[model samples]
Target: MCKEECPYDFRLAEVVSKLKEIQARKVLVQLPNGLKKYYPILRTTLEDLEIEVFLSLSHSWGVCDLALGEAKKTMCDTILHVGHHGQVALYTLSDIKIVCSPAFYKRNPIPLATRGLKLLMAKGCKRIGLFTTAQHLNYFQELREALSEAGAKVHTTQIFPWMPGQIIGCRFDTIVSNLDRKVDAYLVVGGGIFHGLGLFVTTNKPVIIADPYSNRLIEVAEEASQILKKRLFKLMEALDKKNYAVVISTKIGQFRLALAQKIRDLLRGRGKVAELVVADEISPSLLLNIPWAQAFVIVACPRIAIDHQEEYPYPLLNPGEVKYVLRGSLEEYTPKDSLVPNLSLNNVA
Candidate 1:
């Protein structure tokens, strides 16, 4: 649940009013994975407004494709996309009227447990690293100072090229890789799973995540643990997994495709036989040739790759930072262990 003073309610009301005015018959409402908690509320609200809404099960790319199809079929007059700054990848200005709501939380001026300082004092962790989504960077300077006074060295990286308000998933990896091996442990301040989990997975290190609105450090840690356990089980099933041929594309715009290639190489090095599915453009027909492939990993810009793979059940590896699970054959691949850490919070103020 959001804090009692959460600002998203007012914004949701405004967006809903705009949506109602359009009265689209086959409206597409794309909800981000982070906002899963509010899916029921959003769906109920849209239904109450008498709008025929279809929720895209996939991420940004999938949402765009659904909206595009609706536009092509003349099935819907408008699309309402919601979530973090990264959801911008879902549309072109011509296709749909995009409304972005970047979520923000006010951090208490007081430090919460002085995590950085405690690490420094206890383990001599001089070089502390800080990473978070773009929306939360406004308070970074203060957070940095608090850590510094706690006798720890600090380094900060902003994953989004734009301001905190405009940052999204597109720049996640670029920022995360910049901090590789640079600090002892990472400290993340955000409300969603993408930012923290993305950092945790790629960096392969212990991360301390803190959220001010609710008791998210523990909750998120639990969610991450469950996800990791599922991922691990999936990996184990793949031990005898000869049914799938992973595809890597050279298409320049597909960063996820490039990352898919990297993952393919890693898998092959571990004795898996994966195939590269190169194409001028990603389409269902082009992917159909690999009938033996239980899953295809398309790495490209999220917009193009995800738009193309909307109907597929294969898991997608996003270059932007997070490795997302898509609805399809790979859903059954579950892990045995949790990858996130459950750190206790000291909510000051």
Candidate 2:
């Protein structure tokens, strides 16, 4: 049973409005792995509204993973993607009208345990910038008030429609945009070390977690360090490599064919052998089949190399890390652009 403590609820009016506007029939519903639980309720609601709907069972990491094939398979003319807003990925679905509605929390400032605040206070965090996922945005004002009452000056920056002082796993431009502010520490209000560590890698600031799910406040110093250490070790392994496989994606949003070709050209110019390996989904077992490849420079989904380096047999490196491996010498090693390519945020790489 979803209790009052549950922070996420679908905005039915907005979702329904968009669906009706598009005149959608035989709609295909796509949800992130975590948001799939609400599908039954959603199915029932849409059925009552006289719209045929079916669910996509594929794994949805972010806006990057859209079930276009599943939609076509189900003969769906329209797709309703839940949980995340399609900001990062540029998917060009012409015939299918894809409507993205984020899971909004009705309650403002969900009273997660105060232990996270206490932990931050103990670590001498007076000025705190409370960051979280989109699901937790409604609770920010309440969180800010709580922090203020606890004798702390909190700084919160809004990132327009997608993230309002909150962040996703892939995008950490919030910290970059807030570099002018005098923030002592950052509090990632979401679950897991993924978002926290992403912030740490980009800003190198002190990051602590105020996880609502576990209701435990913890520091990410150990986890962040471990991730960096793993990345550094992978770079060391790839330092001597000449032959490399540039993994490319066929997925619409994640397809970096152009970037993959550019990296390949750059590698060839530098007297290195490069091959383009096309994949829809990248996994260790899939890559293990082709173990002939010396090293892999990931072009699709930066998280594959960032979070899952140990899973791969050879060195799996990011674009910037690959450059360092080619150069064999670093001007004080640090991560350039994280996931995505050299857009505006990743100009460093």
Candidate 3:
């Protein structure tokens, strides 16, 4: 039984059974920040089962940020990754048992969906594109039914490596391109305006965030427009910059050496000083040390440039924004072409 202390279902019983089935004596436990408070529940359960648990204190951004290396170093045969799921690769690749235990929120999303429906209908959004984060996926069916019962045509897609109607921060372009033509507006059933803003910017369509935690309907059209304007200003500043540093992530799943190499070559070809900077985590303070580059182009996750631009003193450009620096024209941006390809276990790092 799930404890009353945590609202999310950690599926402790299922995890214990799996560990027993695999005869896993030593296990590594991983949890995202939001789910860290309930780590004691998981740790206690695992300890009761005589499973040696090693907790990872590293940042758990997504399924991509698995603690496989940590498990290897600690001699743990299995990894219990919590809070997200549906993107697991086979154990053949890692030679270790990787169990993904996704935490599902116990709260119903219908109330927030009903409120968002009214807002979406008021904006004349009859065709709704539905999407949400991994935690809210358990309520996806009921939320879709609520929208359809209200006379809205709902469109959903099972994007590779993502559940039906699921959206990751980095893959907004892939999601928008697949559903933009099919829907009039997007209704994201998640916690914040983060995914909603991504959809609005990518498709240039109206987006409604059905926040279950706050029980509110958030319209992100205006916010996305403001973000676009800021990005345009940054891109304009990038055009006149002489030196460039293209950042490539060293994270297992986010590593994109090929795209970073392409950007470096593109800048050097234009008679600009360019070099590739490798990093495990990209932050403003870390980049501030490199004083030579006037601007930096991120080839890892595109959201870093769009959402966290104010933190950096210099202009931060995504791979799609690099065209403005090269051609000196603000043509239509299609991140599908410039960014790295879709992720798969075989291709990561």
Candidate 4:
């Protein structure tokens, strides 16, 4: 991709200034796949500052996925991560410094917000809840003003780490629970169906996605329900499996060994064969290598099971869904906000 055509503000100057403030001689640069195209510009810019930059080839799903180990191994002074908020910066780790530089989308959201407002009004929605991802967070006030002026009651909440109207792939429960009853419909001013579906599954409200890229307003209630049905089917299928492979990711922030062990022990207590599988990257091919295990339970990221369910031939379940299997009922079947049971520094690598 061309640097001139890049739509996101990578805040390269801010990152360079921070590195200079810390007097970082060598640094590790990591970014999500979507932002990797700007690597050449990033590398050349930092090289001009006489900073030795080592690019991490590993994939980063979010701020939760950091390259701390890589930075440590390379003896770098700091790790500059792009494309996500600085939520992880709240926690202090070992010697290596972490700088989370967010990449904000430069696209105008007024047109998409106008389209969404019309759809929400057409649905007879008076009370509206607004949300978005990090990239589109800048448009929150603008969209909220547009909706409020249209005689719609708008509500939003800011949970620590996540900005107001911002939702990650796996986190939206707190924001939804706080405003679910107050709002008639939820509008996600961002790209993709993931965030919209996340809100729909967590609450009983109609979820609308204002995709600036597609220039369309989409309601994900039908699609989210379809996904829930598939998850329920997978959960039911997993109940009968005699053996299971519980997986734990080794990512700096995604590691959940305790939860994996608890799930493994839970299976063994129920007289089922359960083995712990440790991996840096979780994929169908990686799990398929172990044919003995009939089904798989990943205690890491829940999106892996929900978003990539088609890749695996067998039942792929998350830790939260495992409860329905253990209880032998579908009383509380929903995607979780946290990857592990109790999200804390202790549980992560």
Candidate 2 whole-model C-alpha lDDT, 0 to 1 = 0.72
lDDT of 1 at 265: 62
Model 1, position 345, has a per-residue lDDT of 14
What is candidate 3's lDDT per residue for 182-286, written digit by digit as tens? Answer: 999888888877777777766767788888788888889777778778777887788888999999877677788887888788788888899899987799999
Give a tens-digit lDDT track for model 2, residues 201-308: 777767887667676666887887887887777777787788889998776677878778878887777788889999888999988877677889888878788899
Better of 1 and 4 by lDDT: 4
Estimate the TM-score of every prediction.
0.50, 0.87, 0.90, 0.91
For residues 1-349, could you state the per-residue lDDT of candidate 1 as single tens digits?
3434443442556666666554455666655565545666666766877877676554543222334444445456566666544323223355565544444444562265264346434655567676555345556667777877877777766544444322233434454556666787666666545555655554555566666555345323466566565544444343455444544434322324545566566556555566666654466666666667755444544423222334444433333212222112333222211221111111211
Instruction: List the candidates ranked by TM-score, beginning with the highest.
Output: 4, 3, 2, 1
lDDT of 1: 0.49
Summing lDDT over every window of 10 consecutive residues in candidate 3, give the lowest-scoring window.
340-349
**Candidate 4 lDDT score at position 284:** 87
Clashing pairs in 3: none
Model 2 regions more than 4 Å off: 1-7, 86-93, 104-114, 158-163, 336-340, 343-349
Instruction: Indicate whether candidate 3 or candidate 4 has the larger lDDT.
Output: 3
TM-score of 2: 0.87
